[model samples]
Target: MDFEKLLVWQRAKALTVSVYKEMAACPDLVFKSQITRSALSIPSNIAEGMERFTARDKCRFLRIAKASCGELRTQLMIGSEIAYVAEPLAAVWIIETRELSKMLNGLINRISD
Candidate 1:
């Protein structure tokens, strides 16, 4: 199964792009760097996991991606509170992170079984 064929991977890739674009002009270098890294980790991990030879390896990377979703969500929240991110955009990204997390969970369970 190619990671590109997965809807979750597609969504995560899109979200990462959005995050990069949104943070491109951010004045807070530290926050922007951290948030963007978290965003990038999601799809990256998914792709890596899907390419793994074993189910255990796949699950490990998927779990990392899921955790990255949570990390991204937290960063988004902080970005919104600190005015680094617009409230509406942050809300949307946060929702995406939650959905991505759930999707990763489902994928993990399916792979585990």
Candidate 2:
């Protein structure tokens, strides 16, 4: 399957773009970088995983991408708590992250099956 055609990849890419735009004006460089990097990892890992020849390798990549999603969610939560990102925006991101995680889980299951 084409990586771009995957809904999860599309969502991850959109979320990454959103994170970049929202974090653009953040005064805290470290927090901004942390959030953006993890956000970027989701789609990148997904793409890399899809390129793998074996199901095990693909699942491994998806797992890594899912881990990155968790990392991004944690960063966003911290950002919200610390006021780097507003609660509403963080909430949206959190939900988006959750959805992406679910999609990853489903894909992993399909691959395993």
Candidate 3:
């Protein structure tokens, strides 16, 4: 399957774009870089994993992408808690990450089967 055609990839891409927009005003270099890195990892890893010749390798990368989703969720929470991103904005990101994670889990399960 083309990773770009997957719903999870689309959602993750949207989430990453939102993350980038939210971080635009953040003056802290460390947080900005960390959040952006995690955000980009979600889709990049997915694409990289999908190109692999083995399902196991693809699953491994999907798991990593899922982990990155969780990390992004945590960072979004932290940003909201620290008054960087608004609560509503953080909530949107949280929902997006959760959805992406769910899709990744489904894909991994299918590969395992």
Candidate 4:
């Protein structure tokens, strides 16, 4: 299956793009770098996982993607608290991360079975 065809991958990709666009003007270089990295990791890992030959390898990458979702969510929460990110936008991104994590979990279970 192509990673691009997966809804989870598509959503993750969108989320990454949103993060990049919204944080483009952020002054906190360190925080922006960390947040963007976490956001980017989600779809990147999904793509890598889908390209893997074995279920174990695929699941490993999916797990990494899921963890990235958590990392991104945490960063967004911090960004909101610190005024780096707007509260409304941060809330939306946080929800997206949760949804992506759930999607990744479902995909992992399906691939494992």
Supply candidate 3's per-residue lDDT for 71: 97
lDDT of 4 at 46: 100
Residues 1-113 of candidate 1: C-alpha lDDT, one tens digit per residue: 99999999999999999999989999889988999999999999999999999999999999999999999999999989989999999999999999999999999999999
What lDDT tens digits, residue by residue, belong to model 3 across residues 1-113? 89999888888888888889879889998999999999999999999889998999999999999999999999989999998889998998899899889999999999879
TM-score of each: 0.99, 0.98, 0.97, 0.99
Q: Give the TM-score of candidate 2.
A: 0.98
Candidate no. 1 TM-score: 0.99
lDDT tens string, model 4, 48-99?
9999999999999999999999999999999999999999999999999999
User: Which candidate model has the greater TM-score, 1 or 2?
Assistant: 1
Q: Enumerate residue pairs that collide in model 2.
A: none
The CA lDDT at 42 in model 3 is 100
Better of 2 and 4 by lDDT: 4
Expressed as tens digits, the lDDT of each residue in 37-63 for candidate 2 is 999999999999999999999999999
Whole-model lDDT, candidate 3?
A: 0.92
